[model samples]
Target: MIREIQSQHILQALELGEIESGQGLNQEHGLGRPGDTRWGSHYKTVSNVTALYATIVKVLEKIGSNKIYKDDRVKAITVMSTFESFEFVFMIHLMSEIFGITDKLCQALQKGDQDIVNAMTYVKLTKEGLQQMRDHGWEDFLHLVVCFCVKHDVEVPTMDDMYVPRGRSRRFFAKVSNLHRFRVEMFISVIDLQLQELNSRFDEENTELLICVSCLNPINSFAAFDMQKLLRLAELYPKEFPTNDMTMTALRHELQFYINDVRQDARFGDLKGIHELSMMLVETNKHTTYNLVYLLIRLALILPVATASVERVFSSMTYVKNKLRNSMGDQLLNDNLVTFLERDLFSRVSDDDVLERFQSMKTRRMLL
Candidate 1:
């Protein structure tokens, strides 16, 4: 197994792979022994993932602007699909957290130039691409779904002070954790942004046009184009059409009214799946949290996904909250959690300290 006690960049890369993180550099004694988890992250991981997705449309517009990469369809598609992974997705705005790097990375994706598009497309729509999208989509969707469960629900920011990040988070967390719009766009944005970017970058002259065409089919389906098609068809040829929404008959004057109208029709079928997803908050009575906090709850809802992650956290927490619980204040608690959240930071401690501390714990606890 690759040890986090090595380098940070490698660990970050592993973060892209499967490296589970603990509390970051903030924690004390270390992690994984006793108590590690608290109420849980307000935005967790997916909050940020969804935030990036929300902003991705802007990125695609930029990508589509450049003529050079615009002709390189594969590169555009690959760049679009590669972000399916949380790692890549997060990195698009990773620099936004850091002061110096934030401006650069955000600009890189936003610039939508040929070179950046090429780099983004290095890993195109392969098995990896689909998996990446699913990984991000599940997290994004589930995160918003659970946002309503936060202890104190938050609202999407209006003023935009959040858009300006202090040195701490680069304003990334603020956006993702907000639980507005039912997070439906998060799913659609990830797929749509990539598709537009890919289409713009695609070289009509070269590359397999069929794959590109097929990719659009999924995008259209996702956008509910079938309903759109029917609407346009009805408009062009009204007499033959049964109703405005779904196909109609004389008995059902409403015909497809449910599918077309938002208010008059029951279920607000016009919103379709999105309406059901939004109502989940009302159903669960979980309207407290938003953003990353929301994402954590969704992950917690699943047993398998949370277990390994929880074990990793407990292992690190054992190093800290030992006999010192009474002494540890909120500041200390926050610090340890940060370190626990990002285990790569723990490598700074000496090997002797790590082992000696573990041995002492065994001695004090009377455990073998």
Candidate 2:
């Protein structure tokens, strides 16, 4: 039985059926169901093809000299990606229940509904999103570093000349062809490029991560940046900020730039936290200079920098080994180790209780 669909119903159904596919409409209504009604395949006619070509050309032409997008690539992505960002947004803006009908969308969007306009908001990438973008954006940087190391031009680590273990270190990383690559600093180059392209978005959190990554490079890199992220932050968000915000921004600027640049730019002065903490390193401390400083900086950026804190958490190796090494079989030793390591379980017991258990073991046999 042929069920008749009203002209309005067919328009609405077809409109709802329009699919983006980054292609033209009427190509086929593949996205949504069209209620099994067959129409004269007007969607496939020569006229539809010509209309699509015309529609695309018109949009491309209309892109420039427009206020909303500003015809900028980033802005274009921001605007289109915002609209392309969601279906409800597109449907509300277009008002015709259409999917990929560009003319209808443009027309509906021109007379955009107040409620739809109220709901449709711009979407900027969050800090996490920006970091994910950087992880992807800097693949070229890793390739460049790989190339530089390949040519035996890895950046010098120390001020005084010291021979690099060429066999061990050079073989570890890749190489580059150009002698100019000798001057190239991998970490700073990536940082500078990121600052140049997207400096406007650098919040203190992002800048702090930048500082931590800069420290990871073996090279002694002090960047000559045209734009300090701190300066950008000061420009965008002036006046008082929380303690972490100021500290993070200062850390990045100091780490990235040369001594002169840092001294000149650090209006608040060198981060005294590092200096103050170093004073606590007494002669009795077993950790080396490198080890001590590593602990301090790692502690500062614990949340953003890494999972290094979780690594230092073995509380049971000494207790388990001493308690069970002689008396227990290997399987029992494993069980004892796990029990000792579960600090929360041990925590529930008193210190006196542990001493009593050890004393009983001592009475039975020599303590393991």
Candidate 3:
């Protein structure tokens, strides 16, 4: 049905000279099946539905009226009625907008070399955008929805009228205006739920920890350095900081000198990330001089990178230990996973080198 529509539209455009003879429309208008684990897929699915709304409606209408299987015909008619409603159109646009706001953050988090500081910044910006949309965007958003409904021939409810439950008894439900029903119940409620989920995932303690970790970033001549935040960060790790006054004071003193020396030294002036800064410190033997500060830097590097690495490991395990190899022993499984996950390093080893190492490890009766 989509292809038929595309062909007709292309022919019409060609006749009208709106498009060149060799030009063609995009072929990605088909609906997508969203996955449970990735919200980015959901965004793509919703965006496709929005773009192909008219095509979908035409197909459904034709399917409903045509001589088709009874079950499919009945389902098409039911869906067509639902799709033509104001509520459905409104919800579709609303979810499309919400998912559009979050798609960038989702893509960033999926990257292997994602900058933690920049990722956190994206989270902050996403939250602020959602909040701003909730506060001042209802009128404009509703106007856009109204325009879409008008164009698509979907019914637009009168906001000033009292809203009634669609399938329930009027006597059983409380009175509310359509404005409240949409703006408060649907729009605000969905945005609040998203905000709540984000907040729960990145709560105060975790966000503060990431922010403190960003302070150790050596970019722009150690511009993000914050002694107080770093001290608080060290305190979070009680096992390392020891929960003693002396340890805290020594950390504070070390941080003072550490920042001063690193900032003034030309060797450390053009450093990039926390990892390079760590290597430079160790190479220059400053790790021993500012042992406490180096410990904090190590902690900062370990937390976020360790988490991403663990997630990668678990993801890689699915490919290494499949159903056919489900009964593989722990040691062999670990060996296989190490080679698979570190394939870039393993790729440098030759087949002869592996055979030589294997032969040297054990005496074999059959030689290659």
Task: Give the poorly placed runs of model 1, Cα more than 4 Å off.
Answer: 1-136, 144-152, 155-186, 203-368
Q: How does residue 112 of candidate 2 score in lDDT?
A: 18
Q: What is the C-alpha lDDT of each candidate?
A: 0.38, 0.36, 0.87
- TM-score per candidate, chains pooled: 0.18, 0.17, 0.82
Candidate number with greatest lDDT = 3
Candidate 3 global lDDT: 0.87
Best by TM-score: 3
In model 2, the worst 10-residue window by lDDT is 114-123
Among all windows of 10 consecutive residues in model 3, the one with the lowest summed lDDT is 21-30
**On a 0 to 100 scale, what is the lDDT of residue 346 in model 1?**
86
lDDT by residue for model 1 (291-348), tens: 2222222322332232245555566666777775757887997688777777677878
- 141-240: candidate 2 lDDT, tens digit per residue: 3344344333323342332333233325766545543221222343334334543544454444655544443332221222322235333433332333
Between candidates 1 and 2, which one is better according to TM-score?
A: 1
